[model samples]
Target chain A: MRVSLKTVLTLTTLFFISACGADDAADSMWRKLPLNNTVLLTLPHGKVVIELAPQFSPKNTAQFSKLTQQGFYDGTKFYRVIDGFVAQAGPKDGSKKDLSVPILAMEADFKVAKDWAYTPVQQQGLFAQQTGFKDGFAIAYQQGKSPNSGKAWLTHCPGTIAMARNNAADSASSHFYIVIGQAPRYLDRIMTIYGRVVHGMQHVQAIQRTAVIEGEYAVDHRDFTEIVSMQLMSDVAKAEQIHIEVENTESKAFAERLVKRRNRDSAFFYNKPPPVLDVCQIPIRSRIVK
Target chain B: MRVSLKTVLTLTTLFFISACGADDAADSMWRKLPLNNTVLLTLPHGKVVIELAPQFSPKNTAQFSKLTQQGFYDGTKFYRVIDGFVAQAGPKDGSKKDLSVPILAMEADFKVAKDWAYTPVQQQGLFAQQTGFKDGFAIAYQQGKSPNSGKAWLTHCPGTIAMARNNAADSASSHFYIVIGQAPRYLDRIMTIYGRVVHGMQHVQAIQRTAVIEGEYAVDHRDFTEIVSMQLMSDVAKAEQIHIEVENTESKAFAERLVKRRNRDSAFFYNKPPPVLDVCQIPIRSRIVK
Candidate 1:
């Protein structure tokens, strides 16, 4: 179900050209993200901008916002970095006991209704009945369920941000992880995914992976990637504030882009395989609103 | 499609215990990999052992072997490393013109026969009609084709090694790249996959990523990760040669492992979603032959 190349070109031209002036279509497709719901995570390499998905996990988002305002993560270190898995960061100390905030209830945030206007890439998924995108987040839903009763959850694709938990479901307090490699979809519907890295994923990948000794990632706290600071975009000074805009997932341009990706007929490809698409492969373009 | 866990455990116990005395099944499933088809790649951090898949891509494997024996990649720097995509190395000057070996023909080795004795993981894939494993290599094939008629190619899973080429398919020569993050399945049937990292993948992940500027990785050839030496295992002395063995994909133990991954009912998982297995997620356990 790929869109034609001609349609993609036409849409791209019309969208950018109209965006230069004033067009409702363009405006609707490329709206500025709310500053209050965004976080600027500063690393040694660069700043990683994340747009919180409060709509998916409201409780966890609120908890994160509160912590950001209190400068809780100012000097925290990315303690556990497993190569091809995740880069985790939280308090300098391993224990979550000293945290001021109470433990937030575990929010599996797995599903929304089937009629939620998601652009489904496949009717079947490795972990769910169907896989798609919702508000720029990779998601999956159960099959054979009624349209009004179906459930969906975020897939753990690269750049996905989720709260790290212990054995218990409600153990998540302050620790969080950003997926840096292949999508660990097995974690879907099992963890609370509240945000995603909209920009500066290269910095995330730049973080040094903990050394492996006998097949286990050695935990050396002293060599961890230090977090300079984590602050809400709204809390930053007016001149220093960073603005971002993500391409609307429901927009025509997005649909066109999906089609182009599914059936890439570019000169780069010698043999064009089928137009099949993975939910994780779908691009959610995010740019600084300079 | 999944082998039962009870069966796997039983087979493991019986195989190991009986094999200590005498067992044909154990001998067949745990055969040692040929040292001639294995490469020992030395990095600053550690040694990465890759087993060449000559059966899948004979020409590329042969070319790679010849290059290794000649020490062409001994001092080459990992010139173009894109985080979460590929770590490309070979030819410090970024040109293949000076290589002694003639460029091999582009091997799209995408498909084998339906009766190739591959263990199927999924009937459908993001890039191919069916996906499975052949000799521990992730592979894909077209559907409904006769046993000897269908095509199958190696998938670009993490740790996959393929030739780096220019716009032309046959341009690949001395340069090669290794997939480091999510499986870039799109590269399947487009690049010539010759080998896979059977052990010391941590060393590959440990390589520092060159800083990216304006969404492009900064190419500072002088600061690249250097290859100490690249040699075929057979070329090394008997005492220094690293003996390796990979889990047999066709064995009953592999089936059980697949089932365990597909339906993880472990105590750690709070909410066990329906088990769906991605072909890339399946483990082809490789260990030093003690």
Candidate 2:
């Protein structure tokens, strides 16, 4: 809307998003990810850190980890980048068979168990009965936690990293994609999600987009975004490493944060929307800690 | 997914999205827009055609047309652009007072009349009981056609053009914004949506964005995208004119099209999603006609 700089300015002043109250970001409320499982993917523009969701898709993340450790992803180019769809990267097309690594079985979704835990966004979705967060990952699942009563899978939210495959359900290899636009809920259980970008998403957004003519397979050979390297965080020198901490989704403070956002007490929202929020729309806080 | 070029190629082969079955795109199924109410907004890269929704917000569109005729939008810079939010432009900050145009009273929403017309998506939305397309524009509204039973408003879908305003309910003068990313349904009845971009959304996506710090009003001056001109189609020279025809949302052909897309009966979709589509996600067909 016109004169919205003032509005956005007001929002910025009211909520210092980056500097969330020091208490909220305190050590106890935030959880550190396992360095060995985390990836530091360096693009030409900047570095993007991806936290692998091994618990959800062990096979996919394992194969990705193996590929990264072997330097298979170094010099890989983001060959397919649709502005509002996905940014995919890996060895060139048809080259996966040449590598010694075996194609991993798809872990696109799993049956919800009795002990299945998640920070519920508690909103009904077009694709799933319930949508929410699990260990800091956006996900959708069938309602009811009764063992094997429902299925659960990571959602295709922006910055999501999922394994790419062909017609065959389990035909995925090292090639993967990052969700770059609106949440494509249709691909939820069909594609396996391995990880998510926890930092430097702006650089990922800045990735040079390839020309895509809607349904046409028009591949123009131009300067594509290249992957300089993909390394495990633990491998980097201590001084050069950038440690990260994500807000514990299950924490009381995080729940309060969600409630506060759901209830927009701001005068600007004269016509307040329903208390429910879209799972994919909520921003889960993450930060780089010294 | 990997080998997706082949997948996308298959989809292109199966369904030419642009070249829908000739019968589906026939004149009977397509509705022509009034030339005088249509606008051709030219940018540095290309042109974006916008069709004004005068029925919904007459005052707002009238003011915009008057401003366009006065050459008010030419050479304006998209001074504030958030990648996943909005691309705004006009006479710059604190410049609305310099214009002679009066602030149009807000027409953000209206109560549904007995004859309230819409091509019902028949899908529930996060913000309303129903969401759908009305005269080719995405919208959300309270359910029921009974006169004055509920409210309806244009949604903030990608490519939507809405008037920007401050705290005052009717303070919008000239500056406006275009939704560029995920549909922020939360803004439904808060801002006046007078028009929508029917064509050249890609060019708008290619606009240069300003750097923004999360929740911080740190504006770094960069090569901001500029507006060359915005003119009503009727005022354009005959040779330069590009006539547009949109698929009649109320037509049976359009309803069938929606069903086909909603069903997604493809081999790629091993597990189909619910037989429902998000109102903001549906692509209303528009074509250039001689």
Candidate whose TM-score is highest: 1
Per-candidate DockQ values are: 0.28, 0.19
- The residue-by-residue lDDT of candidate 2 on B224-251, one tens digit each, is 8889998999998899787888778766
Q: Compared with the real two-chain complex, what DockQ does model 2 have? A: 0.19
Docking tier of model 2: it is incorrect
For residue B170, what is the lDDT in candidate 2?
79
lDDT of 2 by residue, A90-127 (tens): 77776644365587787988887654656566434556
True contacts kept of each: 0.26, 0.18
Clashing pairs in 2: A1-B164, A2-B164, A164-B1, A164-B2, A165-B1, A165-B2
Worst 10 residues of 2 chain B by lDDT: B10-19
